[model samples]
Target: MHSPTLASIPPEVLTDNILLRLPLRDLIAISACDKYLAILCNSDALWQRKLRLDYDFTVPRDRPLENVSLKTVYQRIGSPRLFVWKCEHITHPVPSHRDFCELKVDRRVVSLVATHSAFYALDDEGKLYAWGEKVHWRRLLTYKFPFGSEVLPVHIKLPTPIRAISCGSIWITAIDTFSHVWFIPDWKQAYRIVNPMLEQLSSEAQVAQVESGWRFIAILTRSGELHVVQPRSGIPNPGQNLELNGSIIWNTPLRLATMPPLPNLPAINVGEEEALSPKLVKIAASEATIIGLTDQGHVLQLSIPVAVGESILFEALECGKIQWEYLPFLSEVEKVRTDPMYSPPETEFEKMDPWTQHVTRFSRVFGRCPPPPYGFLQMPPRIVPTPPCILKISEIFISDNDICAYSTGPSSTILIGSTGMRASDRAEVFPAHQNRPVAHFARTEHTAAFLTPQGKIMGWERTARGKYADEPSMMTIPDSTKGWLFLSITAAGCHFSGLAIEWEELDADTTNAYESASEDEGDD
Candidate 1:
């Protein structure tokens, strides 16, 4: 095994020369020597060198996401889903909204991390909202006393507004007032679950990544080495004076590895060999529990151990089964190979003729689709040629078709102007045409603020089932920009993929009055 004797009288060893240069699985065992050894393990210079030597680490800040907003929301439109905020003459790199379907930022951003819980969004200032709740919230609420007599408090707030947080499935790491760190279980708020009393743990620890699963927390020191600590065992009360250093209590951690890339949510795919209609195609991966970040800025994937849950090697050693396993639940879904699965089955396929519409021969990327019925589309009498200045958008809803148009931003009412249906595929496409929006509804809880050329930032709210206002919803930018106004529709699930923008000249009376007020302020 080529093991070296530590008693050989060598005063010290350079990391590259002796330790970090060793294989990662070997490094963890060796670093358990002391806190000084722990600091050495957390060295990035060592990690970077190891990364370059082993994995395809050349992503100079990987940015498949930048195709939308830049890295920081403050520096740019942090998400591809947002409209880059632009002032009259100033181009803001940061946009107020990423996607039209973006969760409305009522104010305040909080992070929630706990054992066996999916990350949740908390606006302590507003409604308790959640996204990516693949895991149940109720389970987390009763973290400490999970089962009996403990009637857990429905609402639990940290001593202070939690600015940032992270979890390790069973444990929670949070930063609060004065930047002090604290942790607890889901049941801690209901019952006070304190730390395991490890004195060796530094009081000044800063935990990061409240948004990722297998939640990671890094303790950064002024010297820059990052130390990671594991949750303690739920053993019975310890003696008054238990020495903690070299206590053999810490669980050995795994190092960062170059994992697989996540797959994209299904997008619209149509071509010669095949054609399909657009609907809700969920973008998930079989490769589950891939840790990622989501908040204000960077989306860097932090390296963490794969499934080091209860069955950890230490526990397995205490019992038997080393519980480390990869999360393969999400990545194993029976991928709908094509859209046909959503339609009817074999022999009886002809029955689907009445409900769906299929486009033939037009091969163009979304948005600026080529002048319809031109060379691209074969125009089998099944095709309809939309005029020039007009854009053929993805039908808002395949069930009831409506192509939303926009001028500036979404208005109080999106002129669902084109309600008269056309049917080449269906002889009964539109018999109940009243020549107006098939439906007139009000904008409900959804909100979007679009800046007008007149320098007015107009806020809009969507009208939907007062019922769905209670459901998880997102927003989208409207591509309805025309001459002087912008319009679009929003219901439970509308997305803003390609919203068209237009410059409008609002009435002079309002513009002049605002100008006069501005001039008065300038004189003052």
Candidate 2:
């Protein structure tokens, strides 16, 4: 009975029971002190379990690249911090600055989608957390009301691990790992969307992505097929007179649940003689239209059935009257390929802030293989290049009538375009963001937020009379935590949320000095 000394405990118990259960900070501390504990803590199995538990990082079956370890992967992700802010409204109370409230989560956030009533964040391991007005809904008398004004984030359990989610005004559409489509009419429950076409299509090709607008849902398959449908079952109709945030009437009766592919997509030239249909890799939806991006760097738009007081007519759309239309560039892409003065823009790897660099490295190490914000490439194929800049649509953002195209080329500007595709072939570039290359962009109906490569946020919000401000304003965090860097931003209606990481003041100063010296060298 030697008083059960610390060294007497079995190695298995220490590794499985004690070490695995310890917090990261405590584990790191113990690992630094003991050589045996350090070896156990740095094991691939241990770190992979930790990553899956905290960040939803699924370890691939293939061995990682040389010199990469699970311990390094864990360190690269860092800890995620969430911040929220918005102008005050009568029903939803929010702070104008991000300092007054802190949103705590156990794991790292993978994506964020919001509606006017609530905010939802999906963590790395497929755990969904929700906050805001609609987290807890109660029916008092004839009308349903939210339980609280500003609810804190809470874990939401589902039948399976969800990979992607899109939000409507009051509902959410999600795709799980099994390739099954789920519609959440209420935040508390989810129903599997039962359709023969979806079942057949899913069997043939997996559902890679999903997007939801005010009334329509867009499904993109792994084989590059796009389908649009209006969800009718499991949807609680709020009646004809009760208006929701994004309530609108369809031009046809609500009987259209069929998934019809976009007819006659234009083919692109891959070589001198070979041509093929542009494989749609990304899609964005608004109230009245759906925007599509092909793997070849073409942007196409199609109008959906939206009306003031009529129902949607499926028969009208089936007659081949409405089809996808290409949004043409001002000059032919072939011309830029032959220009003598054109030089490719240098990659901005050196200009990225420390937090961005960490994310990029982590993505590469884990074989994630996609740029931040979304899985789109930094540059599209060369066939769709723009003049002088040699730009292609790297990302697209849309809400209501405002849509913007983000390009990655010599002049990486966030080019704003309207939903009206026929208005002009030339996109109206944002004056405030002409020179600033953004790493992320988030837009609501009245607000536009841009995150620079240096982790600074610039926003252009609607004025008092409902027009955009001429000059963009710097979005600042609290003075006490001035050195924090933002990783992502999202907005819906009027509310905004950001994910950031803390950096010490001294380390931040040193990093800024390094960045300044690098910029001077580039200038020289």
Candidate 3:
């Protein structure tokens, strides 16, 4: 007898054993083979299995996904996942046809963040995935992982489900569901929990968010508390001290001091201590400053001073090895006594005013030079306070040295900080024509992109002088992405990657076949 044709075999058998195992590309290609095969291949069960196997995604159990076929689910949650486009600089001799290449993430990503050197994604399962330049991956893995050399995206093992993640130039901070914060300083050190200051606040109140600066960390808790950790000194010079060269020491996380009341806000009533506490709702940080958003929608700013000239003293104090009060008493008495007639005559301690002598002793103890002689020239330390912006900002983005703020009420975008010496200069608000309510925003060193609620992306390029284009223009979405929903966009290493989703619609023939198959199954 002639062997039964493969197509004649029961559809159920082919779907369960064969089509369910096919990869996404192969399935899409074979769907055009025949009506019977197309219908079977698009079955909810077969696509669902493919999704689970390939991307580890599950249709929400609580949602009515039964009416949707697995093919539709795959299109919505799988095929349009990650789209990457390389900039002309990164991809020299650009491709003849400029287009975005799909990066198969192989998972359902819910959130993503990227830096110039690294890209990170958090999947629906709360697992962290990282991919980027091999050099960076190596530096980030250093002595921590045996497989630190991997350049492709790989699942990072963590102690718990990640709720939020933030990355700086080289370090990463992950907040788990339990509100515990884990920090990865670099590739050489193993991940460790933040100090008890963070741990205690996290336990008492849920950590609403976490953010990272080049050398600082900021955390915002549900209780309206803002905590920041920063370095006590500027970048270390290895030539001066090998032990401290390249070493990064973070200060203990400390609650930010209460902010002064907003100009128009009413004064607090007597006996209302809680009113003094700023109810911080969100926070963002730059290399040396932290910006906070209050419940009343005011923006507050604070700077973390990096000790420059007398860093050794600052380091000693930061490490708790020296106390400020003790330094005054420990000043060198012999030096003043021995140098009595060197230049200006030195006054005996008993003859000097107590307060003036105390100040002089304190300065000497901390290694700070006394005021230069009246005629001598001296440069004063540059100390510019970050003036708090009165605008009601809904989101803030800090890239390199530029600060951008988006206001929801006015639907406007403002660029703060000038390119030159005046970084805290007045902000330049974009023209009203370019203003729109931004739903998502991302930036790299020289480019910033914003996604509007209407599903449009607008981008601004920084000029050579460090100013953004006066007006932003709409970004071109690839033709292939016509029907997809853009979720988020991020830039890293001269490339912009966008997360998108597409929904598949059932054709007339496929829909009829599906209905007929349902009837046959009921009859059986």
TM-score (all chains, Cα) for each model: 0.26, 0.60, 0.55
Q: Which ten-residue region of model 2 has the weakest summed lDDT?
A: 136-145
lDDT string for model 1 (1-524, tens) is 76775534242455667764665445655667777666665555455445334321211221112122111111111111212111111122223332222333333332222122232333433222333222344454332211112121233344444444444444445544334444444422211122332222234442222221233333433222233333343322334324232111223342222222332322223353122222111110001122211111111122223455643523432342321121111111122111132233344334333122222122333433334443432311121111112111111211112222211111111212112222111111111111112121212123323222221233333333211111112222335333321122222112111111233344687545644653554456
Ten residues in sequence with the least summed lDDT for candidate 3? 323-332
RMSD of 1: 21.8
Give the lDDT of residue 167 in candidate 2: 77
Give a tens-digit lDDT track for model 2, residues 276-364: 55567778887767777766566677776565222333445555556677665412244323442233334576446435665678887
Whole-model lDDT, candidate 1? 0.28
Instruction: Tell me, by TM-score, which candidate is best.
Output: 2
Q: Give the C-alpha miss distance for residue 208 in model 2, angstroms.
A: 1.4
lDDT of 3 at 504: 41
Stretches of candidate 3 off by over 4 Å are 1-75, 78-80, 87-100, 134-151, 187-190, 230-256, 265-278, 308-391, 418-424, 462-482, 503-524
lDDT of each: 0.28, 0.59, 0.54
Clashes in model 3: which pairs? 44-70
